[model samples]
Every structure is written in structure tokens, then in C-alpha cells.
Target: MGFTSAWSISAHEDAFITELVPCLGPLIEAEETEPGARERWERWQTSGVDDDLVHLVTGGGHVQRLYRGLTDDDPFCVMDDVWGQEGVEERLFFSAFSKDWAVRGLFQAVGPARAALLPGWCGNFVLTSAEVRDTLPRIEEALSCGPLEKADADRRSGLDYLPDEESVLDGPLRMWRLAAQARIGLCGVSLVLD
Candidate 1:
């Protein structure tokens, strides 16, 4: 069964510990200089992130606010992925590349093919995590029975039209707005499903 309608995610104190610790692993790593650096670093290097944790970096305060809301309990001391209003995507991409490249470099440093599975913690899962794999059957069941999932899939498919090659590459902020809205919207959907 698949997820059909959005369910409520209780904003509880332990939600971050159970749900978001994996999602914020990268962010926690990027801000290693902050206080409580040691624990945050260790968690980032060890936690396994699932695919349900969609990476959404935004410039507006909304994204940061969302992160803050989720992490308020433990105050995950990480750099807010929101970097002003211009370089959000660039920063996120760079951070991702840095982690992936650093892992490969570590492999090169120690020995060939030794650094299996990126050494540190898992970032975001793709679409094949075991939890998600199991969850999807339930989700499918829900989707088959309800209208929520079908409606969202249809909506997102429509959004696919907005971020094509010509439109996004045509200008800067033009695509930025579209991309931001799409990302935020999708994130909301994911949270609802979760």
C-alpha cells in the first residue's frame, strides 16, 4: 500500500531526534566551528539519512524558519542552509560535492576501494532505502484508496513544465522563483506524507 493522503506530523520535542537527525546531518557538518561542534560532527559522520529527507535549500526566511521549528528542541547547531537570497543552490551543491568528493579523496589517501560507503554518515537516501521501500507499499495502499497522492502527483507533474531548460536558463531569478516555489511545495507534501 502507498501513502494516499497527508498525515499529521506531530511537532514534538523528540521529533528532531527521531526524524530530523538524519535530515540535518549535512547541515550539522557544515557548521563544525559552532559550539557543541563535537557531538554534532559525530552525529553527522554516523547517522544514516533516509530518502524521505528531501534536501530543500532556500534563500527566504521561510526555509530557515522551518529548519528552526524542527530543531528547536535540541537546537541543532548547524549553519542554516539559507544563504541570503542568491547563492542557496550553489552553496548546497557545493556542500554536497564537497562531502562526496572528500569521501573519494579519503579513499584515495588511505587505499584504493577501501573507503566504502562514503566513510561518514549517509546524506539523503535516493528512492531505494529499506524503510521507504517498506513504507511505499503502505503508501500505495493509501494512494489507491484516497485522492491525496494522486492529486499531488498530478500537481508536481504540472510543475515539471515550469523548470525546463529554456525557461530556467533564460534568466536567473526568473527560474529561481519557480524553483523555490516548487521545492517548498514539494517539501510540504513530503512532510505531510511523512
Candidate 2:
């Protein structure tokens, strides 16, 4: 099976994990029975998570790559090893539970980048409102440049599944737009890429 990425935007991380995740099924059920619940229920259903703490930001594929490129200094250099080696993957998975492992793995994979950029490559991390604010313009520029096709071509020589360029940018653009919203509203956003 191929890798797919999903994003969750949330203001309250603790409540999201402890309270929201566990109650999603009932919430969806309750919403379904309401008069205008379909639209609301549909939003929660799309998050791919069952909870009120986080809203799923939906769009394209290769979001991990797009985010990395947008936030890193040597974006193209990291593209050479987009998925990373086995060791890096193991570390990335480990990072889910250990922040130390995440920091180490991020440095190893991308090499000497800002702490702010680590969340883009790793799972289960939060970006501050300032970080989100700073990143908005870069995300915009990356989307406008439309380099996914070339990046894909440069990263791999022969690939059977090539993603649509438009579709590729949609996810990250939407995610970042949501991040901007969260920042404007004075809330921190947590990014969960799975």
C-alpha cells in the first residue's frame, strides 16, 4: 500500500486527545439525527478522526513533501530522499512518542534546520501562532510556483503513479490557509500527518 497523509487542526491538544478522540462516534451519530446535521456531520467525518477537538483540513497528496519544502531552507536537497531511509522512518515513527527522537530524526533527515521546521517532517507536533503566521507567505509562493511535477521527476526516475500537480498542492494550501485562520484567531495549531 502507498502512503497517504491526513491533517487535523486543533486548538486544544490535550482535550483533543483525551476527550475528543474517544467521543467522535457518538457525536457523529447525534449530528446525523439533527435537522441540519448532515453538513456538520460531514465535516467531522472527513477529519478521519472522531472528535470535536480537531477539524480535518482536506486536500491533495504529498502534503508532507510540500510542507517540508515550504518551511525548509534547502527544500530541493531534502527531496532527494523524500520518504527517507529505513532508519529515518523508524525514527519518525518513534518520534510520535518521543520528542527527542523526533528532533534527532528531523536533523538527520534534513540536516541543521530550524526547530520550527521539524514538525513538517515529523508526526504529532504543534506549530505556534507565530510560526503559522511566518509560514503563510512561503506556502503561497510554493503553491504559485507549481514545482511538484519537476520535484517528483527529480526525486525518482520511474514511477507508475504520478500525482496531478493541481491536486498535489490543494492539500497543503488548504492546511496552511486553516493554519492562518487559527493564527488569526489566536490559537495554536497542531499538525498530525499520517
Candidate 3:
């Protein structure tokens, strides 16, 4: 009933879009030609996302590749409420931990402006292969600033917290790995909020 994150590695954005747009054609035509079709589908929709669409998308390349061969042991996994931004949570009225602060810290280490690019948990976005390669150095610099180090400092500063903090802190690292993999394959990283 909560959020489930899904991502993919694509040769390019248009490749996935080419796969997606056609899938939506029938839905659009149905809405126009069939009376009550829009209402019927809307009944199953939440926040403008059709239930059927999510089911279809989660099965395709744009969603499947990232999920392939993954297991419960993977820390930064799909299908969890571990993400989202403050604006989205407020507009949708879902009170959830977005990991915004945690992720933002990583980007903030790069520059405050880059932090703004952090997308909503359920937001669809892409990072091209070129982007992945280009951003590595800055991302590495950000990593050095200590999402983990900050956790340790917080503890030392008398702010007691859970010992499982490292797992949560690993989001950026996992993200880095994902991006790197995308780069290696000459693909782009696609986050599909389903």
C-alpha cells in the first residue's frame, strides 16, 4: 500500500520511451472512444498513475533489468518506502521517510545546487551514460565527505542512533555502483516510480 521503487538501465531515454509511449496509445484511444473508459480506469488510478500501467511497466526492460538477479540482501533495493521528497509527501498527504536528508547530504557534498536534482521518490527521471561518467569525480568527492562519517560524528556528538545506520547510509554508494554499471554498459539509469 506504500511506495515501491523501480529502476532500469537503458541504452538511452528514447529507447525506453519508444517502448513506453506505444503502450499508452491503446489506453489513450480507449479513453477517447469508449464511454466511461476514462472513469473506469481512473477508478483504479491514484495520483494520475493507472494501476494497469504500473503492472505493465514493472515487467519491461525499463524496470526489469535493475531487478534482475537481485535478492533481499541488496541494501538499496526496489519496492520499498525508503525514498520520496518533502514536496511530494505533502502534496500526496503521505507521511513517509524520504531519505532526502541522507541523499541530499551526498549531493550537498558536491554542491548545494546539485541537491535540487534529487528527484521525488515516485518521480520518473533518467541519468544518461554520459552523465554517469561525467559526475563520477564529483560524486566520489561527495562520498569522501562522509555520509558514513557524518553518521559516526552524529553518534560521537551525543546523538544516539541505531547501529544499522550504515545500511541506510549505503544508499549513495549503491547509487554510485548502479550509475557506474550503467556507464559500463553504455546505458542510462532510469528511475520509474511505479
Residue-level lDDT of model 3, residues 1-194, one tens digit each, is: 54433232222233433443333333323333444434433442433333433332222333232323233563332222112323222112111122222222232233333333333121223444455566566545544445677666344223222455433224343454555665531122223333
Give lDDT tens digits, candidate 2, residues 55-167.
Answer: 22221122333334433463531222322324323212111211122222222222222222323322233345566568777556544334665454223312222344223
Weakest 10 consecutive residues of candidate 1 by summed lDDT: 185-194
In candidate 1, clashing pairs total 10
Ranking by lDDT: 3, 2, 1
Off by over 4 Å in 3: 1-14, 17-125, 145-148, 152-169, 182-194
Clashing pairs in 1: 1-137, 1-138, 1-139, 1-140, 1-141, 2-138, 2-139, 2-140, 2-141, 3-139
- Give candidate 1 misplaced runs (Cα > 4 Å): 1-66, 69-128, 145-194
Q: Which should have the higher TM-score, number 1 or number 2?
A: 2
lDDT of 1 by residue, 70-124 (tens): 4557553223422222533431211112112222222222222221222122112
Candidate maximizing TM-score: 3
Which residue pairs in candidate 2 have backbone atoms (N, alpha carbon, C) closer than 3 angstroms, thus clashing? 60-171
- lDDT (0 to 1) per candidate: 0.26, 0.33, 0.34
- After superposition, the stretches of candidate 2 with alpha carbons farther than 4 Å from their true spots are 1-119, 141-143, 147-168, 182-194
